[model samples]
Target: MIIFRPPKYDAIDHEKNLKESDGLKFATEIYKGQRSLSAIVEFVLSRIKNYVKKLHNFDQINKYIQGRTKTNKSKILLLTDKNKPTPLIKSIAIDYLSSFETAYITIKKNEKDEIFDFFKIDKDIAKLPQIIIIDTKDNPNEKEEIIVYDGDLNKVALSHYLSNFATPLEGPASKRMDLLNKHKNINNSQNNKKDKNKKKKNSKNTANAHDEL
Candidate 1:
């Protein structure tokens, strides 16, 4: 499981600040193996960002991610600290990520805690932001690694760490999304037909009035 906890953004009341926080610049300069993180994570993040650009409703956002996790049998989770103020992207781009986590939960068959099975460590109450990748495949406590990614949420650690563990699956969440989109399309078609009929009726009424004149 990959966890991205954002820092406490104090003064960013506006949404425009997120554009400047792309940490991928460093990720590009840094390479591992034959693959650049920008090529892997950047493309993936961009697709998610683009797909969710117009999405505002959490339910809709949740539905969109139900199927994609099946490719790797990986599940995503979002834990928002209501105590802290998050950046605007938390409601937008990161919230797109929040959708994947949401869909993972709602569409999941079993109600289980399969992520973040780490050791209990007592530390400072001064909470700094962290990107914690907890691998619960063998045992949760032994396989967890954490990097304190303070200052901003845009970090490169999670993309590399995500593909390690195999997650539990209950049923296909994609089915729920399929049905929802099916109904939505049917409704849209019906609405469009009604609109055309209404327009034609208005046109006929105008013609009758002109004949009378």
Candidate 2:
């Protein structure tokens, strides 16, 4: 499993701004065959900055933060199971930002599948700071079900994430939307059949009453 935890950022951390010269250099360094986790993390952070620079515009920023304006900053915790793709978090962030500067992403991986045994740790992490948990694939802790919950309703949660980020060619959301609509139509047809049966019963009762008269 993957988890992201953001520190309770205060004014002090923000104020001690490092000079541009002293910035993290992992982005500039090309990856060798073997690399460290810290190096990869640094690269991700740099990528975040570069991504924001490209799409930075006031109108876009305003649209991104319209509902989230109350908090000057927000933390994004992206968790994915080991089996799922790792790049989903970056794509989702890019979709939301397009180029906003108020969010950060941290990633953690739990390879041992121990989260089930230590349920309290999971709860504590959730409570400590704002976070999001994503469960993918067959984990021992999860039951076999057609649907799962992640704080909000989502008939096609994965599709929503991909739709908002994935390019038009990929069209993850569009395909999912079609499937959802199809499901609804089927449900409506069943409901209509039930309604017709009820009407037929009412008609039979009325005819019997008239015959008695």
For each candidate, give its TM-score against the true structure. Answer: 0.27, 0.25
Worst 10-residue lDDT window, candidate 2: 128-137
Residue 161 of model 1: what lDDT? 32
Candidate 2 lands at a TM-score of 0.25
| Candidate 2 per-residue C-alpha lDDT over 1-213 given as tens digits, one digit per residue, 9 for 90 to 100 | 122323222222334334433443332434452267877775555343222211123343224333232223232333233322234444444433321222222223442134322322344334311223222223444432211124422323543643432322222345555677899999999999999999999999999999999
Model 1 whole-model lDDT (C-alpha atoms) = 0.35
Runs of candidate 2 exceeding 4 Å displacement: 1-173
